[model samples]
Target: MLISMNTCSEISVVDCKETAEKLNNAKRYSTIIIVGRIAIEYIGRAVSYAPEGDRIVLLKPDGSLLVHESSKVEPLNWQPPKSISLFSCIENRLKVKSYRTNPHEELLIDFIKVDFIKICNIVTSKLLIMGKESDIVKLIVLNPSSILNASIVVGTDISTPYGKIDILLKDEKENLIIVEVKNEKAGISAILQLKRYLEYYASRGLSVRGVIVAPSLTDEAMAMIIREGIVYIGIDQLINGIKDIYRDIYSYTKFKT
Candidate 1:
């Protein structure tokens, strides 16, 4: 049977073990969604609430933290500091503390009661795929018929003021194309990010077009795509087309050393 700290008068040895197990898995997954009672204290502040109650907290790999009290879209508190502090478990309680030197600011969070924990591997995999999409986009851009006979003439994974473009290419017509790759569902935000890159290149007086490559797009995103006049390509098609070109090589190489 699972032991809950909420029902018990005090945290038990079993509860500590459970928290340890969840925290270990959370480290492996790189993100943790924890539901429990929590308290936040900002030390040495003139006016501070130091809220304490049942809350859902998200611990990210980059040391970002978010606390939510209700099902509202916005979080109760968000902290994405420059550096992430260490997390320690003491007396069956989890603690996180952050300190700043210049401003002399310190934040402390304590988890008094932990009811449930969820390791967010879905978003973790999406992040991994986001990194690989750069390579896949490069493979797709090299094919003649893939981008309407476009060939890559510039550096890939190009850095811009908005963000990094997954793959940059120039078509036979000498028009520059900005490609943004998303393995998961493409939403309006993704389109907006791609548009930022498009505008950046367009401002340089070059003939530029933006293309969003993703597995699928939301209905609202599709409407925006058409209205925005940006090109869209399904990742499945791009991958399968590349596989077709390299299938024989893979099959032939598999039997060899």
Candidate 2:
């Protein structure tokens, strides 16, 4: 192995076995990047294979793995954070395998000829995202019961002569549901929109539930929903979800300084 003399981060040239040993110590480095000629194999949820080629591999202390090709901005293959990472020297080559238990999926990266490596611990503030109603609705659509007492999400952005329905759901009691989502506080106009959708369905001789989801409701909006019989859902979960994202950014790798 040829190590750079001036800095600890760069490895000018690498020996596979030696590099694998350093990478095996996850606590020592928050991030590791490898530039090499390698091949990849992923098995578990589905099978995938990438033949030997020059590529970049990134390993996170949280046990995530990302392999990138020469061109794309996104990784060609990735394993989510907090998976189990295992590295070894096999037949004079470095092999990295990361797997998660719940999903029972594994990603294998074989470094045929490692050219360069960057190993260092990193510290930074967690990411904060500005989400819109569409973002929360996406999460809710996948897990309908979490937000609504719905058994299934029938559809989203459903079309009607009135404004498009944000979400369409079927409840446990099998009632069709029409949902309108607001990223901010609910107002009288929001209540009126819900009422119009509900009335439209009622005119068609269909019985459906109307719901408006928002962080807060104005006094008049609350009164209007009560009179119109529209259910109002507070968006506490969406607020908490942002906090959770910030916390989970570096859950596995704690910074000392």
Candidate 3:
């Protein structure tokens, strides 16, 4: 989707201060663009099936542009357009123009209601920080004897062909224990995920036990757990049971020191 200033209609004189303020408030997730007329007059058409849904991507300070459709995940329609530049024509009135080589197609953005100019700061730590899940994994990894009596956490987030196992531990008898941690209720899919990890370990000559750790387990999930011979540890049970063990261990270590 291209916008040419030549065929575009003049809406209003652009306000520099208002434009800066509007651009400053840009977000990371999704952006809305209004094309053709000024922002106020063509709100309905721009937001609807008109040319407003085109996503504008700012290239470098040198002025390269990437325009794509919003409906699909992949931008399969992007062709390398050359000599792209943004010009402030007549006060606040702005225009973007680009050219494609060989066939020589000129792409122009005559009028733009919304355009993202600067990079917006996006916080990514929230996505990686799984509160409940991380807490449970930490407790199990730090103090495995609390969950797997006479066991110790050997590794965590262990990778296999099937998928990654949340926690890996070893029991007193030297058998490998694979744990799958879920913050919410253990569902059928969770049981299946653990089962796949178990199969990967079982194929080897190693002795492995599969376990699911969650707040609760559905009846169907529990049935699968029992059939698959996988252990289910409730979050509440672990907290109540493990805290006492941790306290005793801490006290003992403190006394030794």
| TM values, all candidates | 0.42, 0.46, 0.47
RMSD (Cα, Å) for all candidates, in order, is 12.8, 13.9, 14.2
Give lDDT per model, in order: 0.70, 0.79, 0.62
User: Candidate 3 on 1-257: residue-level lDDT in tens?
Assistant: 33323322222235745543443233222122333332111111122122434355442322334454545665412235344333344345555444445554445554554443443332334433335887779878777886678898888878798887889999999999998999998899999999888888888878999888898999999999889899888877877777789688777877776
Residue pairs in candidate 1 whose N, alpha carbon or C atoms collide under 3 angstroms: none
- Over 59-173, each residue of candidate 1 has an lDDT whose tens digit, in order, gives 6766667788878898776656453455568876877665555556556778787787666543434331434665666556566356555366466778998888887888778
Runs with alpha carbons beyond 4 Å of true place in candidate 1: 1-131, 141-145, 243-257
Which candidate leads in TM-score?
A: 3
Displacement of residue 162 (Cα, Å) in model 3 is 1.1
Ranking by TM-score: 3, 2, 1
* Candidates arranged by lDDT, highest first: 2, 1, 3
Each model's total of backbone clashes: 0, 0, 5
Q: What does candidate 2's lDDT look like per residue over 1-257, in tens digits? A: 33334323775445766767767774345688888899999899799999999999888777778898878788999999888888898887888888998889989888888888887666657663437888778866765765554358889998888889999898877778888999888899988888888889889887798888898999999999888788887788655654465465455344421
